[model samples]
Target: MPPPSDGTRHLAPAKVNLTLHVTGRRADGRHDLDSLVAFADLGDVLHVSPGDALTIDGPFANGVPVDDRNLIRRALAAAGTTRAVDLDKRLPHPAGLGGGSSDAAAALRAVGADLGLDALMALGADLPVCLAAAPSRMRGAGERVDPVALPRLHAVLVNPGVAVPTGAVFAALEGHGPPMPDVLPAGDPLDWLGGMRNDLQAPATGVASVIADVLAALTAAGARLSRMSGSGATCFGLFPDPAAAEAAARRLDYPGWWARACTLNPSAP
Candidate 1:
């Protein structure tokens, strides 16, 4: 609120979909989904200062749009803040990680907007969970968000530099959907997540074959469990701890592939 006291920084953590079960298709072509989402410690950063301009800089900032098309711009406009926003982009774009949405959510909270759920949904399907910045069960095209406590996860994220369009993957899907269980089985996070899967993975692999390679590398490098997140091309592996996850990432050295070890933020209230 009030530009976060000016010059304050906010985190835009990477959104990881541990489980995404595509259910049914709506009349408008929107797909219904049930997903369990968590935020990663590794992600982009945003800084706010007293001004109206928006500036972006980071390793992955070269081709990101900076105008109204950018979610941050729209978010700031929606929040009615003119704070000079500087985004430090770290996560790879179109990598199945909701980087932009997370950044926008951070901007909204920074501006102290009290918009309702419907308003936030207008920003993006992932915006609500990103705004909460916590582990939650997301359903019905992301309109329903219920925060849930989850054990911390040590994970390695890998992107093969290929952007997989979400629409294409969905279009390539063969079946209607396999509905996810209403209640998630509780236990160790890794074990529970290992049994679940991203329904989009098969179709997404058809779009980007390299995604298969990414998953293979992760598994071969000693990952207990590995799968693609969200849509495609950016896969993740769950390890026992940060050290193991980091070690697995380092071992899977592929030229031009982006890989990092991060802990999933424990459930936030």
Candidate 2:
């Protein structure tokens, strides 16, 4: 049965890993991770209404699978329900932004899926966190998530039109890095974040040199701190406020690159 024509809208915010540490490799070949995660205010949107087929339309929709392979459809299946989803794919895939996972989590939310965190992790390592859609400390193989308080962050996100494969980046990794301190620092989170690191950034940059350029561009644009998010391609530049982030985003005029100024952990509507 098709969903009602009530036109329910859901926002699937982009997931950003402000600081990611590769802890160790599991016996099963999975790698453990310790990271600070946040969500960007701007991201793909979904509209649920009366229809039979899934439709995708947005600036970044090209090449997105519309078949059963799509995470949204898979999420619906996991929830034992189906609905016509119109996905506005605003974020780029494989850009280290966790766009697909976020979209899947939004579909689950739209249908009010009651799946537990473990079940959500089975869908995707990012599913649990994306479903939470808040600042969190993620550990293990992305299964452990703990909600944390964080100050709103102003940032410019940039993708250099290059897709760095996650597997490739992992294959290029040299070794695991140390995890965050047992207790996060008090006050401004940015100060503590600067001391942490995304262990995948170097390997991802090696897979796609353009990532380095994106980081450099952000730094040159007057960002207080610039670093790669998740695995590769997409990088973030932290600024003092919205005005600074917006200005920095405008200054990043690379052709074919996608850049947006967004607030992480924005106030509820």
Candidate 3:
């Protein structure tokens, strides 16, 4: 059955890479990544209605393109469907939060487009996992996504209001690092996660020095573990509990910085 003509709302949660290890570089120039990915409670929202127009509005919607260049449009085209979309762009772009890809995936679901994994991936590397919108292990230039069991986690996400180009960060990578262990530890996820690393963090910090400051602030705010997410300026701090995470988010005082406390692997609404 087709969705009602009024509209349908979809959540586009933020994608957080808790552990990102660059294992190798593929012949196609894409890096092979071994990472544990998760979704946060907070993210953008999309409302899709039956039409062919696309409209965007939200705090971060000022500069986003609305034409065919936008991922939402491309996704609709790829699915052989069209819909009027109103995107509430909450997350900052190019912040390693996978905002655009998540929005694209939401559009596909809104129109009931069942483009398979391969077709979805062709739209973007992160599309597969964003479509799943669940905790998973991602590998091989993001072509592999295996859902994993993960407990709900309290975390604070921060963005330093700076752009770190993905290409520049990858170009700065000194060398590929080893992949994560074949099996994750059975005990505390935080303990195991603390030992893991985001291979792109160093190079990304090099690209934007402010990232180091964000990590330091997160650690100082009593985060159990702190790390940069994806390729850039956004970082996450895992807290012991919701109260601690919320407190830390409140304590992080920096001009022009964005911070919010959220739960990872939260139940779908």
List model 1 lDDT by residue over 115-175, tens digit each: 6888788989998888888888999988898987777888999999999999899999877
Q: Please, what is the TM-score per model?
A: 0.94, 0.95, 0.95
- Report clash pairs, candidate 1: none
Task: Put down candidate 2 lDDT per residue, 1-269, tens digits, no spaces.
Answer: 11223549888898999999999999999999999998988889899866647999999999999999999988888888889999999998888899999999888878889887767877889988888888899999888999887888899999999988899999999988888897887877778888999999999988999988999999999888899999978999999989999998888967999999999988633
Of candidates 2 and 1, the better by lDDT:
2
RMSD of 1: 2.5
lDDT of every predicted structure (CA atoms): 0.85, 0.88, 0.90
Worst 10 residues of 3 by lDDT: 1-10
Q: After superposition, how far is residue 221 of candidate 3 from its true place, in Å?
A: 0.6
Error of 2 at 196 (Å): 0.2
Candidate 2 wrongly placed segments (more than 4 Å): 1-7
| Off by more than 4 A, model 3 | 1-7
Rank by TM-score, descending? 3, 2, 1
In candidate 3, list every pair of residues with a backbone clash: none
